[model samples]
Target: MRADNSQHIVEAARRRSEYTRSKAVQALRALDAAGEPVTFETVAKQAGVSRSWLYAQPDLRAEIEQLRAVQRRAPRSSVPARQRASDASLRRRLETANERIQRLTDENRQLRAHLAGALGEQRAARSHTSPRGAASMHEGVDIADPVQPQQPIREREQ
Candidate 1:
């Protein structure tokens, strides 16, 4: 139009694109160095750019993909390999737990048997001490004696 500043505008746009690309690269490196996951969204956020823009750059896209692939292949656990528990150790722990459970089960069975015997003895003693006509609280009838028929009542002669 008046001064033909299209060339200047193009140069400015090229510089801005280069600046944005540099920021993205720096962000990617920072993330990698910090052991943080490198992805388009993270880089975009770190660099204050759009994910679409990062994808549009072939070099940046390739780098991000490569890093992501590496991360996927790497173990996700926080524990170091050397510090992790071995199979033998885990097996031993399981065996110990099973043994303890078995011991507890046996103890509980013994305790229940002892309690049943004590209660039976107590009930028998109570039945022997109670009056002949009195009913036992447990069975609603005397355990020591069998049921007896009552004699018929006869009217007295006047």
Candidate 2:
């Protein structure tokens, strides 16, 4: 009786093992149909089997490894291609911007120098003129005014 009971238990265990293996195959098929990568983890999860069980199946293990390798390599090879294009475009834009900034800086310096020279000439003209005649070229507009040096508001406040 004990022998018969042990035999029955062994048969039940075998059936469960087969069921698990069948589920693993179904999982791989579902993944293929959905265009999903058949990695060990995904197959294990979908089949409700342990990773160890998937690895134990030599054919399935080999197939999963191949797919995983392809998935890994495909992305890495394409990334460098994309990065090269973007990097070159960015480098060109940066150089153009720097050149424009340099040109603007030079123009700004020239304008500042011209303004300083004009201001100096205006002061010299005012100093050379007598107080009675110390009026702007637009003398008709200064009927009730006098020519004088302007001081900053900060100095007046002080």
Candidate 3:
């Protein structure tokens, strides 16, 4: 009697498997009709099967995945091939900008050198015209006076 009961259980399981297989095929047809991407989750949901169970069927999984790959390769208007070419053109613009920067840097250095030479000449002329030991002519302050030169030091010493 136990053997008969076990055989009945096995037969019921087999029937359930066949039903699931038919359902999976129907789900794949539905996905194709809808023009939607095929995925394991979508297939499982449509077939009323668990995701783990669908994935365990390797042949069905491979067929659905190949369909998805074909969909991925189809062209879309949003990302055409010319955008990559534009990026290459942008690189050329960057090179031109770098050249301009280098030119400006050289001009700045030349201007700075000319300014330093002019300033040095002005300082030399001022020193030459001013009296010996006198403050700079441009400043207009008395740094030294011949009459009072030694008096301040002598008073401080005393």
Candidate 4:
């Protein structure tokens, strides 16, 4: 009776071990398929095990994850690769655009400075000229000899 009971226990333990290992593999595969880094919590949830249990089996975790990585790179799909390349291209384009914007901004500042200097010089020249006040006076207004404004000039001997 004792021998039979021990055999039964061994069989049960073996089955449990197999079940746990299969679960770990499936969890690892799912994580790899998602194209995301695996975490203990995510693996535990996928495997239907406690996080502590998953962590306790380091060798199994490493082995299963290694296999998952191999499977992930085995000519499966091109979507991730294309997305990576596009992301790199977008980053480069953004950097180029920023540089162009900076250069244009600098050029605009220099142009503004030059225009201001030219305007200042023009203002200084205008201010230096004498004001022409008598240009708008009426032709009939006489400045000298107001009473006899039309009389001819008379010469006197010294």
Each model's C-alpha lDDT?
A: 0.80, 0.73, 0.73, 0.65
Scored by TM-score, the top model is: 1
Q: Over 4 Å off in model 3, which ranges?
A: 1-3, 75-158
Q: Record all residue pairs in model 2 with backbone atoms less than 3 Å apart, i.e. clashing.
A: none
Kindly list the per-residue Cα lDDT of model 2 for residues 1-158, writing each as its tens digit. Answer: 33458888999999998999899988977775565676889999999999998999999898778766755666433232213346678899999999999999999999999999997897578657836355443332433134555544467459
Tens-place lDDT digits, model 1, residues 116-143: 9998898788768866545355544334
Name the candidate, 1 or 4, with the larger lDDT value: 1
How many Å off is the CA of 121 in candidate 2?
90
Candidate 3, backbone clash total: 0
Q: Give the runs in model 2 whose Cα sits over 4 Å from its true position.
A: 1-3, 73-158
Ordered list by TM-score, greatest first:
1, 3, 2, 4
Clashing pairs in 1: none
Please list the residue runs of candidate 1 whose C-alpha ends up more than 4 Å from where it truly belongs after superposition: 76-158
Worst 10 residues of 1 by lDDT: 149-158
Candidate that beats the other on TM-score, 1 or 3, i.e. the better one: 1
Candidate 3 lDDT tens digits, 1-158? 33458888999999999999999978977776666667788898899998898778988888777766655775332332223246668899999999999999999999999999987897688668855545443353445565665334346459
Tens digits of per-residue lDDT for model 4, 21-125: 789768866665675446667777888988777767888667555644644665454233214446678899999999999999999999999999987786566
Query: Model 1 Cα RMSD, Å?
Result: 12.5
